[model samples]
Target chain A: MADDIKILAFDVFGTVVDWHRSIMDEVRSMHLDVDADQFALAWRAGYMPAMQKVMSGELGWTLIDDLHRMILDDLLVRFGVTQLSEEQKRHLNKAWHRLGAWPDTVAGLRRLKQRYTICTLSNGNIGLLTNMAKQAGLPWDCVLSAEVFQKYKPDPATYLGVAKIFDVEPGQVMLVAAHQDDLAHARACGLKTAYIERPLEYGASQVKDVSPHPDNTFHARDLEQLAGLLRC
Target chain B: MADDIKILAFDVFGTVVDWHRSIMDEVRSMHLDVDADQFALAWRAGYMPAMQKVMSGELGWTLIDDLHRMILDDLLVRFGVTQLSEEQKRHLNKAWHRLGAWPDTVAGLRRLKQRYTICTLSNGNIGLLTNMAKQAGLPWDCVLSAEVFQKYKPDPATYLGVAKIFDVEPGQVMLVAAHQDDLAHARACGLKTAYIERPLEYGASQVKDVSPHPDNTFHARDLEQLAGLLRC
Candidate 1:
């Protein structure tokens, strides 16, 4: 069944790149008078709820860039940090574009590219993905995004849109992600699913659930493991 | 000034790749009992009118793959060619993905990529552009399409949308193309424009209008010349 997948749509934030560490490192470099790890968690904690606003029709179509800014503004106040100027706030908001790829990401993706069409299916806007790809040497055949569909992930359209764009059936495309919930949603939309474990996605302090879900077509410890399992 | 441009969005069909020769070669290789060059011309002549249908809302959104197929069907009948099988038709429709770039395309593009965010701003759909990039080794940072905007070339939205996606001012994005009208439209949208001369775009049987347009920001015989002018 894995061999039948023609395109592999990857979830970017945790699966292919380490957003938490990247964001925390950026904050640490700035020497903010706050717990960096906790700040990173606090910022990411708003991602889902922020997307939910658009998904649930509470907000009009919005890019993750806008949502990131909104969350950053609130987090700055909650962390008792001095207010950043417009230029500083803008630079901080673009931190998403500079996230470092996981160690296995580039090599694993290169291997997978030998067989299947690999691209990002992230909530990150096109600018973010393009810049990240350039910075991290991610060899994506294309950079797809939730912005393309004007719908965030977990929405059926986001998964189905990949198939539609590639002119392939849902079953012929696979969604590779670190989150079991993301795989479940892809599976619900009839896409093949692969879950990659990222234990330290949030931080080194908390234990993450890397348990496999029965519905997924493939699950592995990371993209490297996934590539090996796929016989890439 | 040319020095201000950060993103070089390309017009793919003629500027970068020799589409007429490619389509002619693909058609001739089939050994159809028809003039291949004439067939290629007839087929391409239908391109704008077909796109105009969608632009005028006479048709719903459609991919260039489908548009090309529609044009091919009419051309086959008009040229007194027998109908091809479903598989044959599908294979022929994908010839757009196999277009060979001009002599200087790769070297010039590599040079330009060093200084700018290089991407496709073509009328070709994503699948076609992605596959073409893979086939011809066109190293695009991302592939932008009229399909993404659901509007064809000369549409201001298509040009401005490139700026919006990259979060850059229109002046910072240059539209590089072989067509004067395309460059003129980009200029109208406030995008800097570089016009490349593809004298054989329509075929060597007739002279093409490669005359410089006063509104164009730069003019070159090919991408290599453009890169030289930009000092990339």
Candidate 2:
């Protein structure tokens, strides 16, 4: 099974990087008036719908950075946090770029790198992913984002783009993501899928049900276990 | 000067990797019935003209890998080297993916990476660049290619695209290359330029003139000296 896979395309936000905790930490450090958890969750909650607008042609092609900023601007008003200047808002919005990886991410990715080509398949723009990787020491062979394909994940184009980029069959590429929906989409696209158990992805208050599905090719608690399962 | 630059976008072929020597070595190892040096030079010489065809819209957007194979097929016919199977021809074309880095490349890149984002700004497609980096251990922060823009080098789009990817101003991103013409084009796009002297880029017989250019921000004998000059 390990020998059959040539590339492992990871979903970055919740699987590779602990975006919930990372964003929560940033919000806490900022001492914003709103609850840190709520702020973080609210910010992330806007992501999918925002991407949907672009996907539906309701919005012109905008980068994840711009979408993030737009969401942040609305959240600031909704949360009654009005003290930030433009520069402060910009810095706070770039918090996504400083996301720390999960505890096992760096080591697991390094282990996987020894065998399969490991890369980020995320909605994050190239700059955001590159900055996050540099900061968190995620050793990606390459960084592929919606910025590359101009279509966010769950889009067949983004899932299939990985295989096209490497000149391999879709089955030869495995999409490792915490979200079952993402993995299901990849599987539907004829790519193999690995479910990463990120129960705390939405924070401890909202633990996700990481129960294994029969459709997934593999399931692991984290990237370390994924590497082991893949025999990397 | 270094403080002003946020990214160092490198030209991979001659600046980071010694394609001439690497190709020559591969040709020699293959024991092809042709002059290895001439064969290596011929392969590289096909590169620019091929890219120009795509740039001119005479040919549709083509990945460097396909362009390389096209050129390789022509060379195999031109050099009267007909005794090769399809698999052997494919392997020969992938020699580009296995090119060795220059001695100073790894160390210099590590040092420079500490200060600024280091990425590839090359005409090579992502797969070729990613495979080459993985094989050669070129620790690039990101891989930016002509494939990303669907335009080859010397096109203002490729140079400007690097700045756009990093969300930096063109002047904040420096183009580092062994070829002055590439640097000049980058400069014309308002990008800072660093020229690395790779006199043997065309092989030992035809030494390249790597003289200092006044317009360049920095000029060094190699990446090692470039690192030292930048105080990295």
Candidate 3:
């Protein structure tokens, strides 16, 4: 596996960082009189539908940062949180930049870095990724984003963009993600796939029945385990 | 200077990596029966003129990787090195991907990372910068290339593109380079400028007197000195 794989492109939000927990914590700290868990869930819930609009051409080319802000604005209106000022809302929208990594992310990425060129092939914009790296200490060799390709995930362009960025055959670059859809899309584009189990990605309260079965080229409980499996 | 700089977009070739020394070493190792220093110098001398052709509309938009290869191929013919194989030439063309960083680059970048988001704003294509970071341990948070903007450096789009990526004002991003021409171009586009003295960027025998002039917002001897001046 080490000999075959040259680049490891990661799905950042839930796979590398615990975005749900991070958002919930920020909501709690702000004391917005809102359900922190509900706010986190609501924020993530906006992500897919927002991306779908762009993917389906209902919306023009929009960055994840702008999409996130739009969703935040809608969600705030829905929740009737009228007490917050514009500056507070703006700061709250940037909570995505302060996400904490999953427990195994740093160690696993560090281990994998010894053998592979590790990068973020995330839907998150470059600024978000850069700020998150500084906040969380994710040691990516480079941060490759959907923003770079001007396309969202699940698009062939996004998957193929990773291979193009490294100037490698699609087979040489592997997409590591917790989401099966992302892995399947990458596989469709001829990239190797690694499935990581982040069962609590959404939140601990939500029951996610992710199989430990090896559906992809590799399967591991966490990034550290994946690194060990890859013999990094 | 530090307060104003929200993003620090770097010039990769001479500013981040020691291209002259690296190419010279590779040439020496190949034992190609040519003057290694002269070969390296000649190869670099072609860079600006090659970029100028594109910038002036005399040539179509071509990536720096292709531009480097064009220069390399012409140099090979000029030097009468007819013995090289196609595979060797391909490897030689990728020398830009294996450049050695100046001693202070990684350390200074780590420091700068604390204060501002660091990214590459190079004419080199995305593949070249990504591969180079993997090989040379450049700790870039994000890699932005002319490839993304479809325009080479000294183009206002490339300088302004860096600020656009971070959603910052043009005045908030600093262009750091060893070349005064690049700094001047960036400043003309309303970006902050920092000049570093890389007197040996052309080659050892060539005495490059890049003085620390007042034109640049900050001028330093090396990345370490620049980091100190930026208070990073």
What is the per-residue lDDT of model 3 for residues A122-188, given as tens digits with 9 covering 90 to 100? 9899888988998899988888888888888888998898887777899999999999989999998
The predicted structure with the larger TM-score, 1 or 3, is 1
RMSD of 2: 0.9
Ranked candidates, highest DockQ first: 2, 1, 3
Which candidate tops DockQ?
2
DockQ of each: 0.81, 0.84, 0.78
TM-score of model number 1, chain B: 0.98
The runs of at least 3 residues in candidate 2 whose Cα sits more than 4 Å from the true structure, single-residue gaps closed, are: none
CAPRI band for model 3: medium
Native contacts kept (model 2): 0.68
Which stretches of candidate 3 lie above 4 Å from their native place?
B56-60
Question: What's the best-to-worst order under TM-score?
Answer: 2, 1, 3
Worst 10 residues of 1 chain A by lDDT: A83-92
lDDT of 2 at B75: 97
Docking outcome class, model 1: high
Least well predicted 10-residue stretch by lDDT in candidate 1 chain B: B80-89
